[model samples]
Target: MKELYDTISLQFTLKDFHQQKPNLAFATAEKQQLIALLTYMRDVHRYTHLVFVTAVDWLEENRFQITYMLHNYDIKADFGIRVMLDRDKPVMESIHHLWEQGRVYQRELHEMFGIDFPGSPGVNEPMILEGWQGPPVMRRDFDTAKYSLETYDHRPRDTREPESHMKEKLYPED
Candidate 1:
């Protein structure tokens, strides 16, 4: 894997390269060169399987870190490519052309993180959250406590003391 990274470094501009294991590695790349980097990894390096696409909200940094996990069957290895996007305007190049499943992941990211993948199919359409009108819930700034207080109705229900309930259940005969 290190040897592969060494070769890729010569061709692509990558940084923060870390080898987690003999078969698992990750690297950070510029968002502008993501598509080209992904293509090179898939076509030349034989990372044919896209395991998943995920994002991290770096609230303090005011950026969103998108990670694309790819797997190579022949080498039994996994590679992660990370790209940082501006939190103010989270937009990324659509990878649906390379992998069909990318559309689904991008759609979810769009709904949850407010990331935009221009030209992705049905990206604007709601997937899980239908009839929902609120800020992107996955964002760090979205207050769950406040949203729940406003969105859901609080009802009083029967409650029990843990010690008494457990004692009754364990020593009912007594």
Candidate 2:
């Protein structure tokens, strides 16, 4: 891994080595160089499969972590690449050329997490949450209970129901 990585030699850290699958994580401080690394991984190291692309929302930090998982079938090894996006303006270049499956992953991320892949077609289209009208649900700050109550019609709950139920259950011995 080190010899192959040294060829392109963009500064990246070995994030984990002891796990069942070793992983090297790259921070997106140099986002442009990431594509180059992916190309080398695919063409040279033969990590030809793009397993997945996904996002994680960190509400406190106001950032999103985007991960790209690539698999090298010949060696049975999986590699991960990570990039952080500003939650307010979550956009990144798409890896559509390297792997066609990236379109679906990007599109789903856009719908669920509000991340955008400008270069990937259909990324903005509704995929999973076909008619979703609320803010991105996957974001940590999204209040799902609030959205559900407001979006869908349901019978109002009794305000005293919780108190009565708790009194009966906790004091059953009484």
Full-model lDDT for every candidate: 0.94, 0.75
Q: What is candidate 2's local distance difference test score?
A: 0.75
Off by over 4 Å in 1: 157-174
Say which candidate scores most in TM-score. 1
Show model 2 residue runs off by greater than 4 Å.
1-29, 155-174
For model 2, how does the per-residue alpha-carbon lDDT over 126-160 read when each residue is reduced to its tens digit?
99787888888888888889888887899977666
Cα lDDT tens digits for candidate 1, 1-174: 788878888878889999999899999998889999999999999999999999999999999999999999997999999999999999899999999999999999999999999999999999999977999989999999998988899997989999999999999997
Estimate TM-scores for all models. 0.89, 0.76
Q: Model 2, clash count?
A: 0
TM-score of 1: 0.89
